[model samples]
Target: MDLILDFFLVSGIVIIAIILLQLFKVKHKELPQKVLIVLFLLLFFVAIHFYALLHNIIWLIHLCFLPNDITTTILGPLLFLYVKTLFLKEDGLVKNTLGHFIPAFLFALGITIPTMLFNIFKIDTLAYTHTNFIRTIIRFESLYFTLYLFISLQLLSRYRKLSKQKYSNLTQYDFNWIKIMFLSALFIMSIDIGIKLYESFWGDLSWNADYISVLCMIVLVSFLGYYGVNQSKVLLPSFLLNKEKALNIEKTKDKTLSPNKKEEFETLKHKLEQVLHTDRPYLDEDLTLGKLAQQVSTKDKILSTLLNQYLNTTFYDLINKYRVDAVKEKINLDSYKNYSLFGIACECGFKSRTSFNRIFKKHTGFSPSEFKNNTL
Candidate 1:
């Protein structure tokens, strides 16, 4: 009991310390900080309950009296919330936020209420082995395991989707913390299950090993809190054109490289413009600066410089100008009005209705429909 108390205290302090720090880590928050906060609080709850059990605290002793089972119950909900928060904040999937826990919570109630009633019904057997509670916890712990595996799978899917997203100036912020968290959950659940299994088959012998699991969990929570509290710099990826406008100084390199830099840049710009003119490659779905640079035998850095300084526009803005011109020409022809603005956008060069409207409005000071009504 003393050993268990020590385990709970160490882990408990770590848990609470982290949470307090996270509350201080305000201003420019992200998924990582939120995750860390939740983790710290959850561990604190688990550790406190266990510490109470070790001391046979009366209110706790009367209220269910099973430290391990109570902790087990809380774990499932905490983890469910963790995963749900992750999917909601990171992906903006609002529908998925609270819905994922209904099935798990319902199934847990099946195990929890039944196990409690059954224990009351069988005090004789419980007294002999001191592990009737352990047997009961197994069923719910299995549910927790399945929930965790589901969360891991979902995270992997999100990782793949994020990899494919365009113009994500977001950086990977400490996925290592998440990996450690998942592994810590696995280890604790394993110990809980292992203890129950051994007590059921071989009889309750020792409680020494549980301390190791608690310490591991505490360390995990403490680390998560540290990561939460630590200051992470944001890249603040403002649009390049906006940034250039604000800075206002000439963007060209100092002590200009003779005529060489300008000449090289002009050649590359002309080559890309030629392709842009021919294939109307600006219309292609994946026509990024890197892809365009490859075709034109130039670096994106050099092309960007030339486009901004000489053409007086960003590559995105420059590409959209052609699209706008195409749309205007089509609208000028009475035959084109038969189709809608969405149709006209596709005919011009846009990939989606939203992208078309965004770029069109930026270029032409009106929505596609508004521009068409005024001009066409």
Candidate 2:
């Protein structure tokens, strides 16, 4: 058990250190990246705290410089902010959200600082550390973690929905990594809370279950390091920020369009189809609703409303539908017979084979190869 715990502790420390170095080397850091760096730094301190505790390093533990408890308070806020900064395109987002860190700040001031001062004065801090008040505070921290994690997951879901509306290719903007991270954190938090509750009622178990949580943390850290390093900033458009307005628009979709408005949308839809069929703008792998709107000579919001209300489709579905049709057309051609399935998919503006297969199957109920075979 000791051997396994040592391995996890070392692995977690090394993973966090490597990620920190990588983040530090970034030439230009955005708000999300900066938040991510701080997030990992706190994780590093967490790793060190566990190491110190496990090794019985009295001085290191007593120093309270790392303040693992404070990190528990801070991490939740940092995670929510990371998701927010990734999706929201607002000025001074980090600065404006400084209030979120107040709990962590107060924790450091009330608990960690006093502990450090006691250690400096060679005072016994056992009375303060082992109190019922501290235990209650720890429980509250667990609740705090739960609340922020829930909020982050909710925000991620909304962002994903909005992304599908605006961007055709969701490869870069998917934020699946963030979802995985939060889910993993949720798993770890559940384990920790369960164990704590068990200990509160039944006293400590013979074996340490914390080692399991620590091992999971190591794996989670490695996962975050790999994906976080490659993650691009997801700056949502200004219109997307107003989610209330978007919701109102969705609510009004059932309302009948005025005849003039219906005619206007009909003309716009005709022009949109003409441009898509003639110009083949969907063939751009990075095509977006705004780009397609420019090609169709209409505002993106109008184009969006046209697709949503009149066509009974989304921008993503409409664009991908054309691409799939183009693929089917190419597949049926004699000259394109020698082209590989992936080759045909790429030529039809499908960015990746996985997306192509998934989208093709979604639309035609057959994989790309199956479709080609049946048609041929």
Candidate 3:
């Protein structure tokens, strides 16, 4: 058990050091990167706190203990803010999110500082007085962190749904890594809470259950550092960012098209189809609803409505359908017979082989290679 804890402590230090070094080398760090740097710094302190505890380093434990306790509040909010920064392009991100850290600040100022000062000055009276109250507050830390994790997951779900409407290729915008990390954190937190509950009711277990939670935390921090470095800004449009408006637009019930409106829809739809067939705009690979709307000489909202209500499909599905058809046509042609499946998919605006194979299977109920072989 001691060896395992030592391994985790050393691994945490090494991973955080590497991440911080890479982040510091960046000339101009974005908000997400800045948040990650702060988050990892806190995790580094956490690693030190555990290491100090393990080795019975009295001074080091005294130094890190209170700060580590405070970080339980701050770390969750930092991760929530990181997800927010990635999805939303807003001014004054730091200024606006200052409120999220107030709990941590108050805990530090009211609880941590006073407690630390009491210990340092050997003020037995004050330390004894605040002991129970401090324990009560610390008991709620897991719940607080769990709430932030839930909120982060909610924000990620909303942004992912909206992203499918705006962009055809969601490879960069899908924050799946963040989702997995949050879910894993929640799972680990649940186990830790359960262990604590058992310890409270029954006598202390032989083995240290905290080792499980701390080791999992170190692993999670390493996971976040790996993906968080490469994460790109989503840059959703103003329309998609307005939650009330977007919800209303997406959830509105379909109604029968009026004669004049139907005529207008038909005219725009005809033009849209003509342009798609002739111009082959879906071949851009980075095609978006707004760009397609521009080619059809219609507003994006109108195009979105046409696709959603009139056509009964999403912009993503429609675009992929066209690309799939194009690939099928090319596969049937004698001249293109020698082209690799992925090579053909690339020419048809599919970004990668994985996506191409998945989408091709979805559309035609056959893998790309299977479809090509059957065609031959």
Provide C-alpha RMSD values for all models, in order: 19.2, 2.3, 2.5
TM-score winner between 1 and 2, please give it: 2
* Candidate 1 residue lDDT tens string, 1-376: 5775676576566658657665656776665456556545555655765566577674653344343444544555555555444423355533455565565465445544445545556545334333555355454565566466557746644442332221211223324465666667676667766765776687766664555666676766666566546534222112332434323426554434357776776777678778878877656644565566677777655655566565555565676788788887887687875888878777776667767787788888898889877974
lDDT by residue for model 3 (1-376), tens: 6997898799898989999999988898988888888888888888898899889897987888776868878988888889888877768877888999999999888777777778678777657526655665766787789899999899889888777777888876757888999999999989877776676677568876767877899999889988888688887677766654454554333355677887888899899999999999999999999999999988888887777657767788889999999999998687877888888998999897887899899999999889988988
Candidate 3 positional error at 176, Å: 1.5
Instruction: State which candidate has the highest TM-score.
Output: 2
What lDDT tens digits, residue by residue, belong to model 2 across residues 1-376?
A: 6777888898889889989999999998887788888888777877787788788887777653545668778988988898888778659788888999998898888776776676567567534855777766766776688789998899899888777778888877768878988987998888888888888888888876666766787798899889887687776677755754343454454375888898898899789888988899999999998998898888888787788767767788888999999998898688887999889888888887778889999999998888878976
Best by lDDT: 3
**Residue 246 CA error for candidate 3 (Å)?**
2.7
RMSD of 2: 2.3
State the displacement of the C-alpha of residue 180, model 2, in Å, after optimal TM-score superposition. 1.7
Off-target runs (Cα >4 Å) in candidate 2 are 64-66, 115-129, 206-209, 251-256
Query: What lDDT would candidate 2 get against the real structure?
Result: 0.80
